[model samples]
Target: MWPPRRSGGGDVKHCYARGHRDSGLVSGSSHVRSDMGDIGFKLKVLRRIGIIQPTSPARGLKAAKALRTWGPGFPSGVAATAARFPQQTAIHDDAGDITWGELKADIDRYTQALKDRGVGPGVSVAVLQRNHRYLVMTLVAVMQAGGRLLLLNTMASSSQLTELTKREGAELAVIDSEFLEVAKNIPRESIVLAWADDDAPDDLPTVASISADMPSDPHDKPEKSGQIIIFTSGTTGLPKGARREEPKDLKPLLAYFGAIPYRGNSTVVLAAPLFHSWGLINFGFGLSTAPTYVLRRKFSPEQVLKDIETYRARVLVVVPLMIQRLVDASSEAIEKRDVSSLEITASSGSALAGDLANHFMDLFTDSVYNFYGATETGWVTIASPEDLRAAPGTAGRPPWRTTVKILDENGKELPQGETGVIHVGNDMPFGGYTDGNSKSFADGLMHTGDLGYFDEDGRLFVAGRDDDMIISGGENVFPRELEDALIEHPAISDVVVTGVDDPDWGQALAAYVVVKDGQEIDADGVIAHAREHVARFAVPRKVTFLDELPRNPTGKVMKRELPDPA
Candidate 1:
C-alpha cells in the first residue's frame, strides 16, 4: 500500500490524486507505484548527472548517519559535520579557506562570547551584514547560543530596519561596519557586534574582539531549536516576518535533494544573498554535504565567472537577475574564463523567463535549472533543461510528494489550459507570519497568489500575479507573456511590462525597456516586434526606455517603483 511508505507516512497518491479529481481522472494504488518508480528513476538520473556518486555500502552508511545526526538545524549539523569531517574544507571566502575543524572552533568561540552577554533562548538577535565568512559563522553561533535569528535584508532603508526590528522585538543587532548607521537607533550597550573585523564606529564593538579570548571547547547546545525570522521581499507592502519552526519531517526536502544536483566534496559559489531563503537553504545543505562554499561580500557578474574558474566550482547558486547579469557581461570577458568545471547552475528567487533560460543554457550548456516557489510555500516546482526545451516557459511538474492545483476565483479547480490562482500542498507549509496574519488556505493547500495554468502534459506555467493581470477590452492579459516575448528581441537587454490606467481599454499594457548598449530601438519598433510574437491585446500600447529596471535584492522587479505612463 502506498509504495511501502518511503520517507514520510503521507500518502503520495492522495496528494497528487487531489489535482486529478478536478479533471475526473482515476487514480489508485497503481499511481503510487508509478510515483515510486519515478523516484527510483530519478535516483539513477542523479548519478548520470554527476549529482551523486555511484552507491556503495560504506557511502550509504555514512550518508544515513549524516542525515540522522543533522536533524534539520544548522547548529547541531555543523557540530556533527566537524566531528565527522574535521579536515574537510568548509568555507572559502575572500580572506582564505577554513576547514570544518577551524570553523567549529570559531563557532564555539562566538557561542561562548554571545552566552556571556545573556544571548540565549527567547532572545531575538538581528543580523544586518553582507555575505562573508563572519556572517555565516555568526548565524551558527547565535543559534548554538539558543538565540532566535532575525535576518535583516541589506537593501532595506534605515527606517524600514528600525520599524522591522522593533516589530520583531530584536534586542541585539549584529551589523557590518559599513551599515553601522542603519543601527543608530538601537542602544549602543545592547550588544551591537560588528560582523566584519573592520574598525567599528565610536559606539560599537567588533564581534571578533569580543570572542578573541573565549574558549573554543565544549559549547553548550540549545535546549530547543532556535527560530529563524525571515522577512518578505516587501515589494507590495511592509515586510512581515515569516517565522520558521524546526523541521519535524525532512521528507519534503528529499524532493529537492533528488531534483537538484548537489554533491559532496564539491565547491559551491553562493552568489545569492545569504539573507534570502534560496541562499540560506543551500548554505544549510552545504553544512552536511561538506562542500567548500565560496562567499563574497558583494555580487558582481565578472567576479562570479572568475570565482567559478578560480575555485573550479561545481555548482553556482544564483537568482535570475544574476543570471541576466552573467549573460549581459561582455562576451570577451566571459569567454576568457575556463568555466567547464561547473556542472549545475541552480536559479531561483524569481521567475526565470524563457529567453533568459535559453541564452544561459546556450552559453553554459544544458545545466540551467529554474526553481519556482515562494518564501511561504517553499519549493513548488523545478524546471529541468528538458522541460525548458519542451515548453519554453513552463515551471515544470511538481517534485516528489508535492501537489499543485489551479483554482478559479470561486475556489473551484480549473481544468487544464485554464488560468487560475495557484495553490500548492506539501508536508511542510509555513508555520505562519509573526504578525498573527496567515495567507489564504483551503483544503490544506496554501494559496500562492500567483495565476497560472497546467498543460495537458501536467507541466505548470506561471502567468503573472493575480493582481498584476490586466483586463484589457475584456480579454485577460498577463505581463509575463508579454515580457517573455519582448526579451527575445535582439536589441532589447531587459524589460518589464506593467498595466497602466487607460480609460479606453480599462487597463493598457505599458512596457519599460532597457536597450542593449550601442543599440537603438523606438517604441513603434518594439511594438511591431511584439505583435509578431504575442497576441494583439498582449502587445504594449506604450513603451518607455530606461537605463535599468528597479529590482529588489532577490531580483524581483519593484513594479511599484516603476514610473507610470503620462
Candidate 2:
C-alpha cells in the first residue's frame, strides 16, 4: 500500500482507499478518527478551513505545480505520457491510428490555431460532432488554452443549437465539415470553423495569433474557469447546460482513476458517443491516466469485439445497453476473439439489468464493474466486480470521496433498507448552471432525482427515476423493473416501458419493443411473457413494435418522445 502524505492544508484526507481485490466485494470509506467516519471527518475538516488565499503556492496553484513536474503546453495528464511512449497507439478509428506523440502535436497545432481565432480564457467554444480522434484533440486544446469547452450534440435540431449558441453567447464553433450547414444558424456575431482533418491548415488565418502561454501551474487557472459544459435534455422541453469547473481538490477524480485500476499500462475502449458525459469523462480521464484510447464513431456489436481483439484492450467503458448488445451478439466470434487481456470494465449511464449483469460476470469470469453517476452529479457510487458478485443489483457503496444520504420526500434521511431520494456531494463537487436560467448547485449536495435506497450493508440499489414512476390501476410501478423483465423474453431484443395516459386506470403501462431478426412477437405475446416474471399490474397493457427506441446522443431512452400506443 502507498503511504499517505500530509494532505495539503484545507484538503480532506481519506483514511482508507478501496483497492483491487479478487473477491468482488466493493470497498467503502476509510475509518474516521474523530468519532465520525472517514468522509464525515473530512467534511468537518474542510468546513473548518476557509478558502485559501489565491497567491499561496501551497493552495493557489496546486494543480498547476503538479503539471510543472512534466513539460510545457501540456495541460492534460495524457500529454506527459506522450513524451515517454511516443510510438504506442493512442487512438484507433477508421481514419487510422493516432500515436501519443501525433495526438500531442495535433493538440499543440490546434491550440495555436484556437489562439489565432480570438479564443482565450473565459471564451466558450461549442463542438458539434461524433466521437473521433479529432474531437479528443479539440477538447484537450480548449482546456490547455484556459477556455471553457461546450459539447454540442450533432443529433440536436438546428433550432435547438441556434438557441443554445445564443443562450451561452458561444464565441465560436469548431464543427465537422458535415455540420457546416447547421453552423450557419448561429448569429452573425459568432464565428464557425470547420475541423481540419488531413488536408492543409487553411483555416489557420482565421485563428488569432497568440504566443504559447501555459498556466504557471494547474492551480493558477481561475477557480471559476469552466472546463466543460454538457447540455442535458430537460424533462419539460429544451436542454439544460450543466457546467463542470476545475475543482480545487483534484483528489476525488484522481482517486477514481486509481480505484478503477485502469491507468497507464492499459488501453481503455471508448464505445460510447463522446457527446455524453460518460464518454467525455472517460476520454478526459484516460488522458490524465495516460492509457491508450480506442474509439468507435458508433456502436456495433461486431465492430466492438473486433476492436477489443485488435487493440488488446485491458479496460472497457460503456453503457449497459451497449454491454447487452455486445453480449447478445453471436458468440462464434466471441469465443474465438482473444479477450483474456481485459482486466477491468465499467458500465454506466444506466442501471445494469440484474440478469444481464450476471451473464456478463459469468462470461468475463468476474472482471465487470458498474458505476452509478449522472451528468449532473459527477461520481456517486461504484459496484466493482467484487461488489456486484456480492449484490447483483446494488450500485455499490459511494465512491471513496463522495457522501450519500437517502432521504424521503420530507427531506429527512431514511433508515437503512428504506426507499428514498439519493443525494450526493463532496469537496470535488462542480457548481452547476452557467446559462443564467439554469439550475444552480446551491446546497452542498446534488439531489439526484433517482429513487433508490441503501441496504443494511450500505450497498445502493436504484429503483427508478422519480419522474418515470407509473401509477396504473392505482398501483405504483417503475418502468425499469418491468422493462428488465421484458428483455428476458427470447423474442425481444431491446425494449422500453413507459406510461400512457389512460382514462380508467389513471395511467397504463406501455411497452415499445424491438424484436430479434427473423423473430416474431406481438403486444399480447410480450405482455403474457412479462406477466410470468412481474406482477400482472406491472405488465404492459399495450405493446408497440418499433424498429428502435428513441434515444438521446448519450443512449438514454428519450421517454418524452415515445409515441402513444393505439
Candidate 3:
C-alpha cells in the first residue's frame, strides 16, 4: 500500500505491514490515546524506512559508529565489497561469473595497466565498450587510480568517437574488438587498448605489483578526480556534457542507498547502455546493494524475456518503447515466464499514462513502480502501485528529502491545479554543464524544463516539456496528454506529438505514429480516434506514419526529426 504524501511534495514513505492490532478500543478515551500511539508508531516506521530523519544530526551517532568506512585511496568498489562480502558474486556477464574477490583482482591488474600507460590522476580515459565485465573493470581501475572516466557509446561511428575523444582531450581510449574499427579513428596520440570480444588479456598489467606495502593512502585525493561529464541525448541539438561536482560528503549516496527499495540477492536485467546515466546509476545502485546484474549489449523484446527467465532477474529499468514492445510480444510471454522473482519494476525517462500503468499493473500486479526523473536530476519522485491505483497519471510526490515546485514563465510559483515548468531541489543535484561557463542552478533551483502541475490531492502530473507545447488557434496543447490518449488505441504501437508550422494557427499539432504490426491506421483515423479520447484542438491536425519512430540509443523519441508528409 502507498504511504500518505508529505507536507512538501516528493517525500516518499515506505511501510510494510507486519501485523494488525488484536485488541479493539472499548472507550472513546482509550481510542483517542490509541490514535496518538498509532501516529507515533507510523512516525517511527517512516524514520526506519528512510522517509524522515532526526532533526538532531548527532542523535544517530552511536549507530553511525557501527557503519562501514572506506579509506580515501580505496582501490575499487569490488575490492571494498570483497573485503566485506568475499563469497558474494560481484558480476555476472556473458564472459562468465566473477565473485567479489575475483573482480578485485581484475581491477588491481587493470589499474597497473593504466598506470603503465602513463594514465594517472587528472588524466581522462574514454571507454567505448558493450555492457560487459570489462566496462566494470575499467571504471574500477580508473577510479581506483584516481582518474576521470569518459563513457562513449559503442554504437557511435568512428567519426563520432574521434570527435568525442578530441572533445574530452582523452589520454587513452579503451574499446572492445567489435568496435576496433571505430577506435582506429581515435588519434594515435592516445593509446588504444582493445579487448578481443569478451576474452580480455589476463597478461595485461592489471595484475602488476604496486607498492601495496605503501600503507594504502587513506585520503587519496588525486589531482583531478570525480565522476563528471554525463552526455545528454541530443533530442534538440548536439549532445552536451552535464558536468557533476563531487560532494565532499557521501550523505546523498548514503541516503539514496538507504531510501531506494533494493531487495538483496535479486537479479537486475540491465537493458540500457552504461554510457547513459540511467544505466550507470543502475550499475552504481546495484553495486551499492550488491545485487546480481544480467547485462545485455542491446535491448530486444525476445532477449528481455529470455534474460529475465534465464537469470530470474527481479528488477529492470525500462522505457516506454520497451514496455510497448514487451507487452506486444505477448501477455502470455509475461505470464508464462518465471517473472514471479520480480518484486520491483521501475519505468522512467518518459511520461507514462494511466492506461499503460493500468496495463502493466494488471500484468505484473503490484510490482510496477513509475519513476519520474531525468539525466540531470537523479530521482525526483516515484509513483507506487497504490498511487497508480488512486491517481494514474500522478508521478508520486517527491522523495522524503527532495523539494519540487511548479512555476510559470514569469518566475512565479503556480498554485495547485495549474500546469507550468517543474523545478526541483535535491540533496544530490548535478554540478552543471561542461564546455561552457553556463550554469543551470540559477536562484538556487534546478529548472527541469518539464511542464507539470500538482493536484489538490498533492500528486504531480507531468504535462510535457515547456518548449514542446503546441499553440493551435491561440490555445496551448501539451503533447503528453494528447499522446496518452492516442496510445490508448489498440492499433497504435508508438507515437510522437510535435508542433509543426502553420500559417493560420501559427502552429499546429502533428503526430508521427508507428502502427502496430499487421494493423493499418491512417492519419484521418488516428485523428478521429483522438477526437473521441481528448479535446478536438488537441487532436492532431496532421499525422505521418513511419515503420519506427526516430529515437536516440536511450529510446527517447526525437520530436525534432518528425517528418512532414509528401
Give lDDT tens digits, candidate 2, residues 1-566.
11111111121122222211222223443333332444453443333221111234543354345355333222545455565556878888767898877777766776766766766788889888677776777777777667878888777778888888778878887776566567668643454443434552454322212213422122233333336888885534788888765544445544465346663547778887787778876776565555678876667878777777887888888888887877787878578777777777777877787577778767654677777888778777777787788777778777555667666666766554456666776444455777564332223456888877655556777768877877777666678777777787888888888878878788888889999989999877987787677765677878898888887655577777878775
Each prediction's RMSD over C-alphas, in Å, is 6.8, 9.8, 8.6
Error of 2 at 33 (Å): 7.2
Candidate 1 lDDT, tens digit per residue, 1-566? 00111111121111222223122222212244455565575566455434355545564564456446546667766775676667878887777899988888888898898888888987899999888888888788887877889998998888988899899898888888777677777777875555545465656667777888999985555686677888889886778899766566545545676567667778899988988988887887556465788988889888999999998998999999999999888898889988999888888998887568878888876777788888788877787888787778778767666778767777877653456778887655587899898789765678999877666566677777988887887767778878888888889988988898788888889999999999989999999988887777777888998898888888988776888753
lDDT of 3 by residue, 1-566 (tens): 11122211233232211111223221111232366654564455445433244433343442232123332122433444455555667666676787876666666666766676787876788887777777777766777666767877555667767777788788887767567667777664464444454454443222222323223222333455545467777776666677654444444454344334655556788777777776776676455344667776667777777777787777877765566667677766676776666666667667775477777767654666777788777766667767778877767766544667666676676654456667776666576666774435433567887777655555667777777877777666777777787788889988778877878788878888889888888888998888777665677778888899878776787655667742
lDDT value, residue 321 of candidate 1: 90
RMSD of 1: 6.8
Misplaced by over 4 Å in model 1 are 1-30, 34-70, 197-199
Which 10 residues in a row give candidate 3 its minimum summed lDDT?
A: 14-23
- TM-score of every prediction relative to native: 0.89, 0.81, 0.81
Worst-scoring 10-residue span by lDDT in model 2: 1-10
Which predicted model would earn the best TM-score? 1
Give lDDT per model, in order.
Answer: 0.76, 0.66, 0.63
Candidate 1 TM-score over all chains jointly? 0.89
Candidate 2 segments whose C-alpha is farther than 4 A from its true place: 1-74, 83-87, 187-226, 234-236, 437-444
The per-residue C-alpha lDDT of model 1 at residue 62 equals: 49
